[model samples]
Target: MTQPNTLPQVQPSTTAIHAGYTPSGDYRPLTVPLYSSAAYEFGSHAEAVEKFALRASGFTYSRTGNPTVSVFEQRAAALEGGANAVATATGQAAVALSLLALTQGPKHIIASSQLYGGTVDLLTDSFNDFGIRITFVDPDQPAAWEAAIEEDTRAFFLESVTNPLSTLPDLPALAEVAHRHNIPVVVDNTLATPANFKPLAYGADIVVHSATKALAGHGQVLGGVVVDSGTFDFSDEARWPQIARARERYAGTSLLARYAGGAYSMLVRSKFLHDLGPTLPAANAHSIITGIETLPVRTAAAQSTLLLLANFLEAHPLVKAVHHPSRTTHRHHERAAKFFPRGTGSVLAVELHDADLVPAFIDNLKIIALAANIGDTRTMIAHPATMTHCRLTPSQLAEAGLNAGVLRISVGLEDPADLIRDLDRALAAAEVSGDKSTVKDVVFA
Candidate 1:
C-alpha cells in the first residue's frame, strides 16, 4: 500500500490536473473512468442497507451519486478549498439546490443586485412562488446587506465577479457582515473561476460554479457544482434546521451528526439533489473534469490577451467606457489587485458611443462569434440589453451597468492581433452606419 506520507501536498495547478483518480490496478486508466450505469450492485444485503442508510459511503444509484460525478465533485471541492461538494446537471440547478438546502418555505435570502439575469428570474419568479423572500442589494454596499438581513434570512449570495460587467464584490466584508448576522455566504465563482479566484479563500462559506463556462473550457458540456468550506457553525440548530435537526432522508439522523465536516454537502446530495433530479451525466462530468486540467494555462493567456484588448478598446474614439477591474479607473481596481493577483478571468464589458449602431457592429463581427456563452476557446460577443440581460428591468439594468450600448465580450485563446482586427472592423462598420441618415437601433423585450 502507498503510505500517505510518501508524497507531499501538491499545489492548486497540480490538484486541478490530477486530484481524484489514482492508478493502482494492473490495467488502470490514466484518467477518471466514465461510470454510466444507472445503478450499482451491492456485494451483500447488509452492505446495501448500510449504503442506503448513508452509513457506508458507496454508490447505489446514479441519481443521488455516481463514481465519475463524485470525482468531479471532490476535485471541485479541493480547488475551492471546501470540505466537500455536490455535482448537478446545470449551473442553475446547483444555485437553486444550494439555497434550497438552507431553507424550505417562507424563509429569506439576501442576494446581490449584480447577479446574472437568469438568476434574477429564478429569484423573482420561481423562488417567490415557492414562498421564499429575496432582497437584492448592490454588491458594493456592505451596509445594504446588513440592513436587508432578516431573522429568517438563511443565506447571503453573490457572485465573486459579476457577469456582463466584471464587477468585484467585497467578499471579505460581505462575509463578515453575513457571519455577524448568523447567515452563511454563498458565492457564484463562475465568471472568475478558481483559475483567477476562489471565494472560500476570501471568507465565503459556500462556493458554486457553472462548470459549463470555464471549468469545462469547451462549450461541449453543461454541469454545476456546490462546494462548502465546512467552517460554518451549524451547531445553531435553530438557524440551520436541515443540517442540525433530524431528517427523514438519512433515516432520521441529522446530517451534521452523520457526516461531520461535510453535512452541508451531504444534505445537498441526499435531499435537494435527490428530490430535484438534476443529476449530472457521467460523460458531462468526465468532460468537465478533463477541461479543468488545462484551466491555469488557458486562463493565464486569455486574461493577458483580454487586458490588451480592453486597453485598445478604451482608447478607441467610438468607445464610451470599459468595465474591467484591471483598468485603474474601474471601481474595483484595488479590489481586483487584492483578490485576483493572477488576473481577473477573461471577460469584459465595453460601452460603445452609439447605441443606435449596435446592430451594424454585431453583424460585421467575423472571427469573434455572437454567442451568449463565456469562458470558451472561441471569442464570443453578446449585447446584454438585447440578449443576456434583456429581461432585466430598466432599474436592474442600470444597477448592473448594462446599457443598450454595452457589449459583453468573452475573450478566448485566439491571437490578440486577429481579435483586434475583428474589433476594428466591427467598430468601423458601426461608425459607417452612424454616417448614414437611416439609424438602426436594436430592440428588446
Candidate 2:
C-alpha cells in the first residue's frame, strides 16, 4: 500500500474525496474498504509486544484504530489542514474529549455565550461538576474574551459559525489572545465545514466537527472528529505544566515532545479515546466516508438554497428580521468574509414578527421538516427559544441573541421555489392564527 500523505496540501475539493486512503486489491476499489475486525493477529508475541509498547506503529484494537475509520480520520485531517484527527461516536463526544485531554480539575475555560445549547450545558452544567470552571463571553466583543481569561485557563472554546444565530467570530484575533496566554483555541467547525472554512488555517489550535452535519452531507451518520494542527508548543514548561506532568501516563513521553505536528490528536486517540470509548463503528465510518465524497457539490447547492431562503424570509410579512453572517446587517459580516469567505453556510435564523405564532407556523410547513438536526439533504427548522435553548434562563437566552420568536433554518439541496412556496403558506396561515394583539410583532418593516 502507498503511504498516505499527512499534510493537507491538495485542494480542498479534491482532498475531501481522495486524501485519506488509496484503493486496495488488483481491482482498485474506488471507495475505502471497511475493515470490520476487532483485533489484528500478530506475527508473534514479540511483534505484539512492540505494538503494545508503542514502539511499532500498527493497529491492535478496533477501539484504538481501524482502517475504515483511519481513512475517515485522515480524510478529515487533510481537509481541515490538520496533522491528525480522531473519529468519535458523535459531535458531543468530540467536544468532551478535546476538553478532557486539554484540562485537569480546577482548570478554567472561556467560551462564547452565543453557542449551541448543548455546548452551554456541557461546559457550564456538566464540566462544572468535574471541578472545571468556565466563563462564557460574547464572541462578538473581543474585549470580553480578553477579560474572561484567568491564569488557570487552559483552553478557549467557541464555534466558527454559531448554532442558533448564524454569527461568525473573529478567529484570528481570538486565537492571538489565547496564544499569548499559552492556551489552545479549540473551535467547533461543525456549521461551516472545511469546504467553506478551515479553522486551523485561520489560527485555531484544534478543530472539532460534527461529521453528522455537512461532512456526512446526507445526515446518514452520527459522528464527529477532533483535528490537531500540532502547532502549539506544549513543551514550554513555563506555559504548559499539565502536559509535562502527564508525560508518564502516555508511555513516559510528553505528547508534545513525542508527536510534533499531530500531538494533541494522538493524545486524544491514545488516551481519552482508548479509555472513555466514544469510538465510531466501522460501519458508520464507511457511511460517512461515502457521504464526504460529494460534500463540495452538496454544500454549494445548500448555500444557494440558503441565500434564497434568507431572502424570502427577509421579505416575508411575518419575519421581523433575518440573521445570516453574509448579510451586511449582521454585526459579524466583515469577519464572515475574512474567515468563511466561500459562504456563511446554509443555516440562518429568522425572527418571527409575533412570538406566539411560530408554533402554528411550523406545524403548517409541508416541505420543511420540524427537526433540530442541521446540514441534511432535506431542510430542517427549529424554534430555538422552545427547543434547543429552552434550558437557558430568559436572561441567558437574551444574552445569546435568542428572542422568544426566533426560528432557525438549515436549508437543503431542494428546489428554491418549492422551499419558498412551502414557507409562504406556513407564514400566511400563522398570521391568521396569531393573536391580533401580536400580529404587528410578526411583520417585518
Tens-digit lDDT track of model 1 for 1-445: 1101112477778888777667545657677778889999998999999998888987889999888888888889878878889999999999999998887856999999998888998898899999999999999999989999888999999999999788999999999999888889999999998977989989999999999998999999899999999989888888878888887867888888988889988889888888879999999999999999998888898899998899899999999999999899999999899889988798999988877777788888999999989999999999887778778787888887677778899999999999999999989987876643222243322
Q: Note the clash tally of each candidate.
A: 0, 4
Q: Local distance difference test, per candidate?
A: 0.87, 0.84
Q: Which regions of candidate 1 deviate over 4 angstroms?
A: 1-7, 435-445
Question: Which one wins on lDDT?
Answer: 1
Candidate 2 RMSD computed on C-alpha atoms after optimal superposition onto the true structure: 3.1
Task: TM-score for candidate 1, please give it.
Answer: 0.96
Model 2: per-residue Cα lDDT over 1-445, one tens digit each: 3236444456777887788877666877777887888889999999999888777888899998988898998899888888889999999999999988887756899998988888888888889999899988888777788888888899999999899688888888899988888889999999988899989988899999888988897877799999988788787765565465456666776766666666777778888899899999989989999898888888889998888888888998878999997678998888777767788677989998778887789888999999989989999999876777767776778788888678899999889999999999999987888644442243222
lDDT of 2 at 380: 94
Candidate 2, clashing residue pairs? Answer: 230-261, 353-441, 353-442, 354-442
The root-mean-square deviation over C-alpha atoms between each candidate and the true structure, in angstroms, is: 2.4, 3.1
